[model samples]
Target chain A: MSRWKPDGRGRLEKAALELYNHKGFEATTVAEIAGRAGLTERTFYRHFADKRAVLFPSDNPLPAILADATASAPVPLPPLEVVTHALIEAAPVYEEREDLVRQRQAVIAANPELQERELAKLAALAATLTQALRERGLDTTTAALAAEIGIAAFKVAYERWINDPDEHTLAQHIRETLDTAKHLTTPAEHAAATDNVSFTGQQGTA
Target chain B: MSRWKPDGRGRLEKAALELYNHKGFEATTVAEIAGRAGLTERTFYRHFADKRAVLFPSDNPLPAILADATASAPVPLPPLEVVTHALIEAAPVYEEREDLVRQRQAVIAANPELQERELAKLAALAATLTQALRERGLDTTTAALAAEIGIAAFKVAYERWINDPDEHTLAQHIRETLDTAKHLTTPAEHAAATDNVSFTGQQGTA
Candidate 1:
C-alpha cells in the first residue's frame, strides 16, 4: 500500500488515478492532476508524457525484467516452466506496489482506450519473452506457445490475487494458476477425459 | 478460395482492406474506401461506423455462431472440448474467405491502432464465450479458462494455417494446436521431463 508521499511522481500518480476515477478520464486534465498533487504542469510533464502516460508509465521496466529473468535461467527448463520461474522471481517487484497496481487496473478497466493500451502492453511483454526464449534456442512455435502460456498465467493470476479476500502473495497466486493450467494440458488426464471426443491428430497430419 | 462476388459489403470490405493496406490505416478515410468500392460515402457509413470499423466488422456473427454451437452440444463435454467442437462447426464459415482473411491480417499487422481494436474484439469474443460457457452451468473459473484457451487456439491455428503452404484446414490446425497445448500439461510427461521444476498439481488434483 502506498502512503501518499511528497515525492513528485508518486504524488502525481496517486492524484491522477484518484482524479480519473472521480471525474472520468476525459474530463480530468493534466493541470488538475498537477494541482491536486500540489505540483506544476511542468513537473507533471517531467514525470510523464501526458495524462495517459501517468498511469501507463512508458519507462516501466517490467518487460526488460521479465526478458532478463527468462534469459538468465541457470538450468534448462521446459519453455513454459522457464517463463513461469522467471515470472515468480520477478513477482516481488510488484508485491509492495499492489495499491497502485489495483488503481491502474481499475482506471484501465473503466476506459476502452486505456484497456487497449494495457493489452498492447501485455502483447509487447509476451513478444519480448518469446524472443528471450528463442535466444535460449527453442524453436519458434515452442517459444511462442511457452511465452503465451506464461503471459496467460500472469494475467489470470494477477486478477485472482488482486480479487481474493484472503490476501495471498502475488507469487502464490501465479504458482497456483500455472499449476491449474498445466494440469488441464497433461497427457494422462487428456487420455482419460477426452475419450468421448475425437481429435484431428488421430485422423490426419499437418 | 472465395470467388469475390459483387455484393455491396464484399466490395466495400475489399476496397477498404486494399486502401488501408496501401495508404495506411490513419492516412486512409471512409470516402476513399467508398470511392474505390464504387459506393457513396453514405453507403460506407451504412456498412461501417468509421475507418477503424472498416477493418473490424462490427456485426461479425462468429461470436453468436460459436455461442450457439456451444449451447447446442447434446451431451455434457469438458469446457475446453465444448469450445473445440464449436470452433470446428464454425470453421466451414471461413473456409471460403481465406483471401480476405489474409488481407485483413496483413492490414492489422501493419497498424498498431488497428491491432488495439483487434485485441478489444478478441476480448469481447472471449467475454461472450465465457458467458455462453457459464450459461451451460460451468463455474466462472472453468468458463474463463475454457474461453481463453479457445481463443488462444483460434489465434495460433489461424496464424499457422495461413502460413502453411499446403493449406491445411483451419479446423484441423485448431485441433492439432489444442492437442499440443494439452500434451504440454500432462503429469506423466512432467514427471519424466521436469525434475528440475515443480508444479503444485504435480502432487495431486484434476
Candidate 2:
C-alpha cells in the first residue's frame, strides 16, 4: 500500500494479469489494476502506457540484450552459432522470471489482439537479431535467414522449457532445440538421395 | 462494366491495388474500387469482404495448395525437403501473378494492419505445412521447425523473385534460397571447429 514501493511496476503487472485472468482482458480496467496493486492510477500510468501495454510493454530488453550478445560473439563463427549462442547466453533473462513469463503467455494466448502483438514482438526481435548479424559482417539475406531460424529455435526451446516436467534448464532446452532444428535440415545418412522420393515435379510454366 | 465478366474477382483485385497504391489503403473505398474496375459495388462485395479484404482475401489458396503438395510428396524425404518441395510445386501461384503480388506487397508494406494480416497468413501457412509434415510421420517439434524454416526460405526467395530483374522463376529462387538456408547450418570445412572462435562463452547462470 506504500506509495514509494520499490517494485511498483512488477506489482502492477502481477495485479493486471490477475485481473485479466479472473475476468477477461477486455473487461479489465486500469483503475481496477491499480486498486488491486494498492497503488494510485498515476503510479500505474508511470509504469505502463495503457492496460494492453501491461502485456506488451514498450521497453522490452530482450531484443537489445540478445543483439548485444550476438554482436560481441567472437569473429568467424557461423551466423546460426552466433545467434543461438546469444540466445543461450540470455536464457537467464527468462529463467529468472519463469512464472511471470508463463502467466503472460497464457493471458496473451487467450486474446487475439494480444496474440498479434506477440507475433509483432517476435518479428521485431528477429529484425534486431538480423541487424546484429549484419554488424557481424553477414550479408542481408544470410543475416535474415539466421535470425529467423534463431527466433524459431528460441520459440521451440522456450515452449519446451515452459512445459517440461523434468525441470531442465532453459539453456539445455535451447541446446536441444537448436540441435533438433539443425537435424531437421541435415538428411539422414541412411536416407540416400537415390532413395529419396521428392515432391511431384509439377513444374510451373513461369 | 459487365457484372457477368468471368474475371470479375481479378478485375476487382487489380482495381483495388491501383487505388490503394495511387492513394492509400485507408483512403480507398469499395465504391471507388468497384468504379475503377467498371463493376458494381455489389460485384466487389461478392468477391471481397471489405476494403482491407481486397489485400488479404479470405479464400487464400496458397496454404491448401502447399499442404496438398507436401502431402503428395514421395515418402522418406527430410522434412525440410518435403516442405521446400511443396513450396516449389506451389511457386506457380505466385509466378503466374507476379505483378499483382508485387503491387500487393508494396501496399501491405505501407500499412501496419495489413502487415499484421500478412504475418498471420504466413504463420498459418507454416502451421499448415507443419501439419502436413506431421502427417508425413515427423514429430511435432521437428515438423514445426521444418515448416518455419521452409516459410523463411519462401520469404527470402519471394523477395528475390519480386525484385530480381533477370526474371527467374519462383521455383528457381526457392531452390536457391533453400540451399542457402541449409548451407547456413553446415560448418565450413576450411573453418575448423577447433580454430573457430565462438561466442564469448558468457554463460547465463540459470
Best by lDDT: 2
lDDT of 1 by residue, B1-206 (tens): 12433477778988988987888878888888888988888877777888777667778888888889989975446667788888888787677788888888899999888888888887787788888877875555546666776776677777778887885899998887776566554434633533433321222220
lDDT of 1 at A21: 87
Q: TM-score of chain A, model 1? A: 0.86
Instruction: Give candidate 2 misplaced runs (Cα > 4 Å).
Output: A1-4, A189-206, B189-206
The CA lDDT of each predicted structure is 0.75, 0.79
Residue A189, candidate 2: alpha-carbon lDDT:
38
DockQ-based class of model 2? acceptable
**After superposition, which runs of candidate 1 have C-alpha atoms over 4 Å from their true positions?**
A1-6, A185-206, B1-6, B74-76, B186-206
How well is each residue in B1-206 modelled by candidate 2, as lDDT tens digits?
A: 55448999988899999999999999998999999988999988888888988877788798889889999987867778888899998898888888999999999889887777777788889889988877766666667778887887787788778888886899998887777776566557313421342331111210
Candidate 1 global CA lDDT score? 0.75
Q: Over all chains combined, what TM-score does candidate 1 have?
A: 0.85
Task: Please state the error at residue A49 of candidate 2 in Å.
Answer: 0.6
